[model samples]
Target: MWVSSSAFEALLDSGACACPVRLGQRLDPSGEYVRRYVPELARVPGDYIYEPWKAPIEVQERANCIIGRDYPAPVVNHLAAAQRNRNAMKELREMLQKAPPHCCPSSDDEIRQFMWLSEEGQATATVGSN
Candidate 1:
């Protein structure tokens, strides 16, 4: 419940996951979490271990974790994707705000059902209908 709520909040706020390295740095400054869970990054220097893709080719070689070969490069650029999602969410929020009250959920139960239907890719035309 907590995790789901947090993720939903993050999506509403930034349309992106909190930066893993930043969170890790706050929780475990030594990068212990990455070293333990991501063996490919075990030998990377603490400065670059959290964001291995930022590490230079020489550093990657030394760490024995080539960004594209050892560990796949990111398929989507996170920053760009986040910005795109944020814009789309902003537009959605604007559209929703412009909609009539009857088109919006007015109760917690209705809100939950609406969100569930949205997640399931189902039509939500009846969400707040009388």
Candidate 2:
């Protein structure tokens, strides 16, 4: 459940954790998955199904799924959250790069300690004793 800083950075850079709307558009281009699972969107056209909030009022009326009343708008702004995560990861990478070579954890216990420090918002903390 944990990954090295480089691996985590690669994941973020790869957009593997993109928001559900992007994932759905990529994996289910035809919106079949959404239509099958979400009855409210079953009648929505492929263009509007994935991101119903962007659908115009006419489209919503035609689809019979109101953004707020029937389907509900997205609660979180995925783009903002992703940007914040990227910023945090960038800071962590900078901290790791500035750390002394001896501060790099080489063992499982050391790695765990390093991770604990990171989770505690102490990415600047020394990882291993010199």
Candidate 3:
């Protein structure tokens, strides 16, 4: 079931992560969603649309979309982003471990300060101390 970041953090704090959390992995490597919004990559091949940076110059010519010219290079590498998120989660969990005992965040403002919010509004993890 879907849960907000604060709720998910509460679950983790309660040691419920023993069951798997459905952290996302790469899907739609064809960039279907991306292409729908980013018209620059629409002409890109199905193989290269998801990884425009990896598209060779020849493919760029064929697609008429140059990486970094027609379409901006991905601001963050996917693997790097994933790793960063994982590290942030680890740090948050550690921070939670050291948090003042018997104190729990109650308000949305309080809880948000302890979580990471992606540009897409996905709450990835808790961050910062009180």
**Which of the two, 1 or 3, has more TM-score?**
1
What candidate 1 gets wrong by more than 4 Å, as runs, is 1-17, 102-130
| RMSD score of candidate 3 (Å) | 11.0
Q: After TM-score superposition, what is the CA distance of residue 114 in candidate 3 from its true location, in Å?
A: 19
lDDT tens per residue, model 3, 14-83: 3222211122115554567767887887888877665678888999988889878887877765566556
- Candidates 1 and 3, the one with greater lDDT: 1
Q: Which lDDT value does model 1 have at 41?
A: 84
Instruction: Give the clashing pairs for model 3.
Output: 114-127
Quality of model 1 by C-alpha lDDT: 0.70
Least accurate stretch of 10 residues (summed lDDT) in model 2?
Answer: 1-10
lDDT of every predicted structure (CA atoms) = 0.70, 0.74, 0.61
Compose the digit string of candidate 1's lDDT tens values, residues 1-130: 3321222233344434455557788898888878999888899898887678999999999999999999878778767865676677677756866876534466656765757756434334455444
Ranking by lDDT: 2, 1, 3
Best by lDDT: 2
* Each candidate structure's count of clashing pairs: 0, 0, 1
Model 3 misses residue 13 by how many Å?
8.4
Of 2 and 3, which scores higher on TM-score? Answer: 2
- What is the lDDT, from 0 to 100, of the residue 113 in candidate 3? 58
Q: On lDDT, who's better, 2 or 3?
A: 2
